[model samples]
Target: MMYKNSILLGTIGGYRDRFHQFQKDRSLEERLEIAKTIPRTHGVEPVYPQDLGADGSGAAAVKASGLAVSAVNVNIKTEPKFRDGSFTSTDAGLRAETVQYIKTAMDLAADLGTDMITVCPLIDGWDYAFQADHQKQWGWTIEAFAAATAHRSDVKVSIEYKAYESRNHIVMPTMAKTLHLCDRVGAPNLGVTMDVGHALIAGECPAAELAIAHDAGRLFYVHFNDNDRGADWDMLPASVHLWQTLETLHYMRRIGYDGWVAYDVFTRTGDNVEAIASTFEIMEDLEKILDKLGQDTIESIIASGMPQQGYRDLVKGLL
Candidate 1:
């Protein structure tokens, strides 16, 4: 089967912490070479500033790693809190700092030939009170980001959402809310970074969510991983919702989503490259399944209201 758009398949840099034990202290350049060696890899490598540090030096290190800075995940709080309305004057100040940091990262990403950055609102811990604080600062963060990204058309912003893991545990954390935040901020470059693991945790089908985002035209980036009803984030793909993973990819193909498929997994051991590659291979196999299933049959199954069974049969037939 011939794929049309160039899908940017890459792993997050944090994988180094998992794969190489003694190489943990390796410079960003060395780590990046390992990351860049992966097949069909592209896009800017993701840097978690809180884990790595936020100075300009971090950005320089990302560039030196031979990987473009695809995006960065900035931690909003050092510790998790259960209360809301925690947006102290200090909190606002920290928000400002985050905006400035994003601007710097965008500049560096541009220099390194990447154009996307992800900003997470808050860490896990805040309850409804935290949601309230998020609602309050949401507007400010968007406005600040819009202004920061106004001059840089190539750089886009994605809001990463999670349920219960890192605060803001709403019964249903919808992309609609995320898109609402972007609309309120009124930034053309802002979009949603849909993480399939979170969607499953929220008890929503990842494929349906992708369809919704595609219909609304708000999807910008994607995080590929799997989770079972009892599992937490970063679980292996095949172990959790194997069919849904394939269905999600089929839906992405139908919607023509040509963004990066970022592996955002965190394991206890940290050598997730094998797992990451396995996940990619699963996705690739799913692609071939879709090729054999054909668009008409796939669409018919999606339209037939038997998505789960139909998708499973489709995969079974392919195998």
Candidate 2:
């Protein structure tokens, strides 16, 4: 099948973490200006409220940079109040506050001209067994999301699932669990952001997860990064698991995913611009490799169901 390649590229504004040595904290505008300098990126994702600046200056700066607003990330784990949990908190008052916060963020996302908002429940799970009430917490989590999207169905909420980060464990830790949450929430606008690093850490096939979410019609967004199967270091994409990342890209093309593919790399040292540019360069190379592999060859391999034959041809092409 002849396919036209078209995908909007984006990056998280805060991925440019400042290291005490080489990098320093840059204002939101400065970061956005840096993002615009990246050739492949057409947009920058800024976290709501904090990254929006005091008087819409941050959003204005992004606008002035001629880059699109990919999405606004709603941070639920960073604040002290959400240490236990936010959406599924047993503290009713805290849950109320969390719901209100999301609503406010939703409004901000609309104002930013991007209907997408990412919700990463990084603190919504327990580290130990018997620490969380499974049924009750599940209900609360679903209710909070439902309430957030009830008023405005147009604003899509994409939940980014990570196995763990802030807490020893995170709630809704996998695509299957996340898609189940979306179903339970029963909101048309509720979807998911499939982060490749998280998928690798979760021991999941990134390509399969992408296909699953798309089949469910809940694949709202994507974040591309790589990590050793051990931890979410948020390294450059295709850095660790080359073949798996390539296969993931293959499936992305197979499904005709034209949505935003955001680079979600983070660093505590080294030049952030170079890191981002390097990822873009790697992506350019991967795209060329993918072009050479072609959908027809991949399809034939899948059809044959014989791994050795496919491997032989793939090795020949590489050499």
Candidate 3:
């Protein structure tokens, strides 16, 4: 699975829907057709089970599009019942429902010929101190994930983490923290979705974190976007954090991360197609610069333990 320059780029239909919210709800096929217009994009990541019709027609529509299914993102955060939490909720019934939903998603993903399922328990956290029992909630969350993945070892379950969304503090908030949860779950299929913007907000160097996840054998997928290091703005790729995003992509090359490099952007006020094209254009430019740098030179820089001097010299040499 050597992704290299041929990284299977993808994007979300939800972003398209949100961008066209003032218009009308676009069907999965319509969104898939829109994505097909973008160059270099080979897939469309549709929301799971919800998008998959009861008669399997929705999955059939996606398959007919001839676009690959990147991964099925099981949404668990929007309902009123999940206002407090979902997997870690005190209500046993709600916990059971969440686990069951994940299992169904895994089965559907397998059916769709995709070997991955992305589960982000975004609602499993608190906005205030003492609002929820931390220790107990952690236990439930781990158990729920373990149960979900235990159903099928063939399908990988990647948990996307964020510092805060739907709450002041999210449970799996950082790369290290999410990796710790993966360890506790003790499931071989469990991994992390290295969303770069979230990593930046978590105060982590995205390249280093990518290396950590790859070394741990837990880097499943990557969500590409940019932000001002203050929020998960989901802006276009390499928009604000130019150097950091470049370093992150360089490390992706370094580790041979052969996974779907998704263009998870939010273009609320911009032309969706142009935004997607611009992202690809920027990626192409940055990748060309990286190609000029060459893998051997990058390896040499990493080999030198003094990263500060290596980076300084590399920049000066480029100039």
Candidate 4:
């Protein structure tokens, strides 16, 4: 596989949900140390401001850990000031601060020898209809993103769209909508960071999303996780959607995607180290099976438009 892997910082930090929370809260140094032990991984994906050290000491810590940076996850939602929204905030000052923060993150990414940053604007959405003017918010967001991306040509700034959670309906909530931002901003470096779990939450097929993004030349990055077809569980890859995982990997190869596949799993109560290692282990299993079956063979089945035997062949390959 040409694809490299990165451990999402949240995976090692600690996981929590409505019913459960992480047993222990480990420091960033401890998490990175654990990250260095995971084999075949390219690096760690840390969030800005929270996981990053703005004073330069944090970068030194990362360098000492002997792991490279896959990408900087820019967080614009946690601050109380951004509770209403970041990019789409009604306050012009807040919006401008958000843009400058993202720009700084891009500069940090370049300084760290990486060219990618993932932004999940969870707070930039409305909970109900007629709460805000959609047109105005959209324009504000596009202009904010345009300024951020225009800061540099080499750094790739991507939007990771989610269906719901922080709000009822998010501004950028799908691959197509994310592509819309890329189109509206008209920046070559702006793209989509397609999170498979989020795709499932939005009731979309991962393979199809990859094909669309690939066609757009905006498939900047990928985040790998699974869910039960409803919530954004962020469970281990292939834990619930076996075929979805296989199909997604197949399409990635078909689309010539060589970017990082982030292990965005939430260990909840499981061992963190085990979660990291097993994510790669599962990918190895699926990737090998795909190779054994052959991409051309699988494509032949899909091209024929015959479902029964095609699926049978896929399942039989596993046995």
Candidate 5:
């Protein structure tokens, strides 16, 4: 059976504490030696870039330590002290900074042999009045990204959508909305980065959306996390939609989606090491569940006029 290049899952935001607690002031080289030992279904593990104090010892340090870094995620909203009241502010200084940052990341990805980078337009703790302004800011950000990546066809840009956590809300907070933004950006390198957890939180079936995006030719990247209907973001793995996740993987296989499936979660609540290991185990189990289902059986059930509940039962039987 054909599959995407292997599904590469890695920690984006939660390894800092793990490094400090377990490494005991060891250098990043030592920390990466530990990261390399974690068992993964996919051979590649990419770390997200964030500031690491005055020493500049975060992702850059990790990359310098010789562990393979395949992707880098830039959180634009988290930058310090670039306060612009509106997206249209177009402060020459801010634009310059944003452009330079993007270029630097693109260069870093090329250097590391990474194929994609994700940009999240998340704003924190804003009021209703900021919604329109925030949307405009996202538009501007998209334009800036398009301009920055116009010449770099080797690297792809994924725009991730979230519903009401980082900001009071997000403008393009759904797969459909994200597709529209991608159309507006209209760059060859621009595409939607689908996060399964965000889709579940928005009360949408991720499997259905994956099919829709695949049909529309807009699905480029994926993030795997889970949340219950009533819960906030980053709840846990398959907490609300185990069946949906299975269906999602199956659909990706059906549509021949060959892209990265990175894990986007926080490990602050407990032992980060165990949490990461357990999450990988769960993901592997999910994949096995999909494998046992077999594409022909799944397609036959849907064609047989069975209800969605029956579909779930069919998958469970395979499991």
Candidate 6:
């Protein structure tokens, strides 16, 4: 049950927000080539429409690049019409289009020889109180997922929940709520993509979040990145929450998450390639450290349930 380490190809290109552009842009071919040169990451994920359009050129480029397709990241946020909301949009037509687009994304994932797709409903939330009808939007979200899951049973559709970003409060802000969405939708293919940074910003321990999703048997994919408690900065792994990331890695192995452990890191001044490659190196180092500590010792510490400072002493070894 080894995890497949991967990188979201978008992180290596020019990163821009409303305020500034992080780096110069690179073509899809260039991004793919750069990814192939990095160590420990044998898989690369590309975005839908933006990177891999319906024209099949992007898919062909990925196949030609020789790196495995970890998962196809469907773009549900960048489009203009989806600015206000996507699945939870007040416009019925926009909601329906989003569901159809998800189905199309699943099709593309299958075409690219993968069975998983990660989606983040980034633009689907509210900015202020009473801005959205909670009940109706929740129902629409359920309906959209139901339709997409019904369209295909072979492909796994995973939702990436962010605490907040473009909107003040996102509709699916937590993994528990997201699993409820899966419950309401009742789709076997539907699951959760536990982004560590998102979980941290939501005030939840990444290890605890992993335990919950894994217990529910809805853990489909994973995104790895560290962040300060207040913001999802997408910093290199273990940069801030070293302890939590270590605990999460233990839980990830315990749950047997044999999917691509992709990254969502963004660098404004540093070299994006170096940042991503070093991120993977850190993860590998953490896993090796765990080996040094021994899983039996850590599990015994957890089972002890002792505020007896059981595994707390292990941090000294890491330092």
Kindly list the per-residue Cα lDDT of model 5 for residues 80-178, writing each as its tens digit: 643432122357567666666566666666766677777666652254773455565666766676776684888877767777655566656788877
**Pairs of residues at least 3 apart in sequence or in different chains that clash in candidate 3:** none
lDDT of 1 by residue, 145-164 (tens): 57666757788867776666
lDDT (tens digit, per residue) of candidate 6 on 121-205: 9888888888889999888999999999999899999999998987889989999999999988888899999999999999998
Write the residue-wise lDDT of candidate 3 on 117-228 in tens digits.
8877888899888888999989998999989999999999999999988788889999999999999998999999898988988899999999999999999988888888
Estimate, for each residue in 46-115, the C-alpha lDDT of model 2 and write its tens digit: 7755777434456676667676777777777777778888988889999988887777777777877888
User: Residue 25 of model 3: what lDDT?
Assistant: 49
Cα-based TM-score, every candidate: 0.78, 0.91, 0.90, 0.97, 0.80, 0.96
Model 1 Cα RMSD, Å?
4.8
Off by over 4 Å in 3: 1-24, 53-57, 303-313, 316-319
Q: In lDDT terms, how accurate is model 3?
A: 0.79
The local lDDT score (0 to 100) that residue 43 gets in candidate 5 is 30
Query: Where is model 2 more than 4 Å wrong at Cα?
Result: 1-22, 53-57
Instruction: Tell me the whole-model lDDT of each prediction, alpha carbons only.
Output: 0.60, 0.78, 0.79, 0.87, 0.63, 0.88
Assess candidate 6 and give its lDDT.
0.88
Deviation in Å, model 1, residue 102 alpha carbon: 2.0
Model 6: ten consecutive residues of lowest lDDT: 310-319
Clash list (residue pairs), candidate 2: none
**Model 2 weakest lDDT span, ten residues long:** 1-10
Candidate 5: where are CA atoms >4 Å away?
Answer: 1-31, 41-66, 82-92, 124-126, 130-139, 308-319
* Model 3 TM: 0.90
Regarding TM-score, does 2 or 5 come out ahead? 2
Among all windows of 10 consecutive residues in model 3, the one with the lowest summed lDDT is 4-13
TM-score of 5: 0.80
**Positional deviation of residue 124's Cα in model 2 after best superposition, in angstroms:** 0.6
Q: Which stretches of candidate 6 lie over 4 Å from their true place?
A: 309-312
What would the TM-score be for candidate 2 when compared with the true structure? 0.91
Error of 5 at 296 (Å): 1.8
